[model samples]
Target: MVSYYHFQRMNKALPDPGSWDEYFETFLAGNVVWGSWFDHVKGWWKKKDSHPILYLFYEDMRKDPKREIRKIMEFLGKNLKEEILDKIVYNTSFDVMKRNPMTNYINEIKMNHNLSPFLRKGVVGDWKNQFTEAQNKQFNEYHEKNMADTSLDTHFRGLS
Candidate 1:
């Protein structure tokens, strides 16, 4: 949500939340530009079985890129050679993508990269650095409440 807010702010599509607490509060209230994150996920989770949805998680990809890439290949019915798969994994890595002008969005005029890069610290649990103890507790409670009805696994290893 923070990343999305930063992107929107950079594009001049949304106003700042002014403070970290306010930002989190806004998220919990579902007052974001697109809507609540949980609603978005729940909507997709509900429709996944009925639709041809290839639901993927960022943490899963980060944990095992080859496995995730293989899942994508299987979904798309693509059977590339092992060497090609290796190259694909290499090219799509966070470091490679961050450096690649085409993938990085560095040239985007609307985005203020000076404020925050489009691809900023592609790692799990970076939110730990930003969230206060109280905010984390609040967020966890909110997450539990929002996600109670769904079978979606929200756990992200060290994130919690």
Candidate 2:
């Protein structure tokens, strides 16, 4: 949701993960690769739309977590008091998220991949260092056409 290296592998910046339908792509690769966003987002969105479930992306949280959290509370039909909201915000910041046990992926899976602890930098725009120009162009085209909304992408922070 909050796009990152999850779209790209360490070395391959322009990989086509696979196709969901005949039109869009998704990451069916053993390892993630650069710019396969259409596949990933579209796949998840299709699944989410089918289910009576909510899917929140990381970029939305990163941009205004309190707002997003309030949305969550509203969705759950709970009104968290302002004080509790403050506490949640303080505890859910990137610093806290990295260390928090509840959000750690290690507890959720029996992974064979050597993933870092839940705190893989937690900052945005890691792709600038990784993506070649051609790869970025391809990624952007796919993302723009499929996503059509730049609002959700957190990867472009203008570092370049």
Candidate 3:
């Protein structure tokens, strides 16, 4: 069965009109969200023994970009000048990426009805503005019930 995500993707990417057109896709998250962090982490974890994969958390990256940079350097077995490492970390921050059209891809997605701003307030607690208490409870329940088998965790981590 095609996933709602994939279906949405296919519908948008197809150039021609509807009425059963053969084509590719475009996708969006229902709540302007990204793919579930826990599921992705767990999926990569499950494949770790048999395949090569690297899992990263945006929160972790935000908290300590230099450390994340070092990890990437070590993973790729590359050494770089200290200044370059600092530059890379600084350049990759939410603030930097949001301003750089190349990184954010805001213009292209802006024309998309389903897609909103590629980068919102990079600050963490933005969801609080949009979700009510009841919605949050449902959000937690959804994760707790469906993501039960996954070991990953999520914090409503936002921009500081």
Candidate 4:
């Protein structure tokens, strides 16, 4: 979904929608996708040991940031004050983060602000707004085929 929205925003970089199956194939088969998948799998497996990886989902963080931050603090073996935790949660909220130049990438790119916002609606369902029915179907088919028989807990639909 992230990739779909990204390509939709940079539509000029996308292949024509008439060849959406091919486009989805190429996009899903890219090194970035495979790399991310492998990394996620590695993290998932490693998160079971004493010195485990701290796995945090973006959706989980968005839904309950205070709880997520507490988890992070626990993972780091830190018992920060409640005030400090609240401050961290407030600072890291999407609205606050979006306004922060360091987090938002306001000056890093060369696009018109009106057309291309660095922080364009930090919500989950933006892909539904951009993806056509055909494109969505093709992407789902490709995704299911590629990810078949994997133990990876994607939790994507669950989040939605």
Candidate 5:
């Protein structure tokens, strides 16, 4: 869901189209987003037991940073101190990451900060505000049809 919103936002500055509907149609028609991601994640998920693949959901991590970080550390076989974990949580928090010029990619591409700040609102459900009714309908239809067989948990079911 957030990925959809990210794409929609990216479409705003891209040379794809003027309107959201047209932009979405063009982007989806290109088949870059879903095709690449599905193939990559599906491959990783397929060899989960054989390889060290821990499926991490963004929503789950956002909801519980400490728990998620601990899970990640465990996956990597790293048992850091509690204070260090707390420090990691504070340093990697959305606000800190967004504020840190080193972490944010605003300077890497020489993007004008006045026109676009690298990191926008780091929150879930922002897609509901951006996606229009017709856009949602189209996206839902396309997603339902294409992702019916995959195990990718998109969590995208229209707006509400």
Candidate 6:
């Protein structure tokens, strides 16, 4: 959510809140641009099997990008050599994307990269640094309530 906040701020697409908490409150109220995250995800999750949707988790991708890439390849019905898959993994890596203007938003006229890079610290569980204990507890409760009906697990192990 911090990343999304930064992106919106950098692009001047939304009004700035006084602090992260303010933005988070707005997010919790489902006043965000795309509506509630749980609603959006749950909607997709429901029709995923019926549609050509391929739901990919960031944690799964970060854990084994090569494996994820192979899944993507198979999903697209493409048969590429192992060497090409290796190249795809390397080119799509965080560091590579951060340096590549084409992949990063470095050249985007609306975005102010000086405020925050489009690609910040690309690590799992970075939210730990942003959320206070109180906020964390509140968020967890909110998340539990919102996600009660869905099988999606954002808190799957190995986040760190």
Q: Pick the candidate with the highest lDDT.
A: 1
> Cα deviation of 116 in candidate 5 (Å)?
2.9
Residue 11 of candidate 6: its Cα lDDT? 69
Runs of candidate 4 with Cα error greater than 4 angstroms are: 1-25, 31-51, 108-115, 158-160
**Model 1: CA > 4 A from native:** 157-160
State the lDDT of candidate 1 residue by residue for 1-160, as single tens digits. Answer: 6677567656644576556677788888999777899999999899987999887888888899999999999999999999999999999999999999899887556677777788888978787787777878887878889999999997633335
Question: Which stretches of model 6 miss by more than 4 angstroms?
Answer: 156-160
Which of 1 and 3 is ahead in lDDT?
1
Give the lowest summed-lDDT range of ten residues in model 3: 20-29
lDDT (10s digit) by residue, model 6, range 25-143: 88888888878877888898889768998778787888999999999999999999999999999999988998998888775566777877889888988877887878777778888
Tens digits of lDDT, candidate 4, 1-160: 4544343444444333334444455555553433445345655565566667777777788889999999999998999999999999999998999899888765524433554566767786666665677667766676677666565565544212
Per-model TM-score on C-alpha atoms? 0.92, 0.58, 0.65, 0.69, 0.77, 0.91
C-alpha lDDT of all candidate models, in order: 0.81, 0.56, 0.56, 0.64, 0.68, 0.80
How many clashes does the backbone of model 1 have?
0
lDDT per residue for candidate 3 within 75-117, as digits (tens), equals: 8889999999989998999899988988866434323434334
Task: Summarize candidate 2's per-residue lDDT along 127-155 as a digit string, tens digits.
Answer: 46655565566556655676774344534
Tell me how candidate 4 scores on lDDT: 0.64
RMSD of 1: 1.7
- Arranged by TM-score with the best first, the candidates are 1, 6, 5, 4, 3, 2
Q: Over all chains combined, what TM-score does candidate 3 have?
A: 0.65
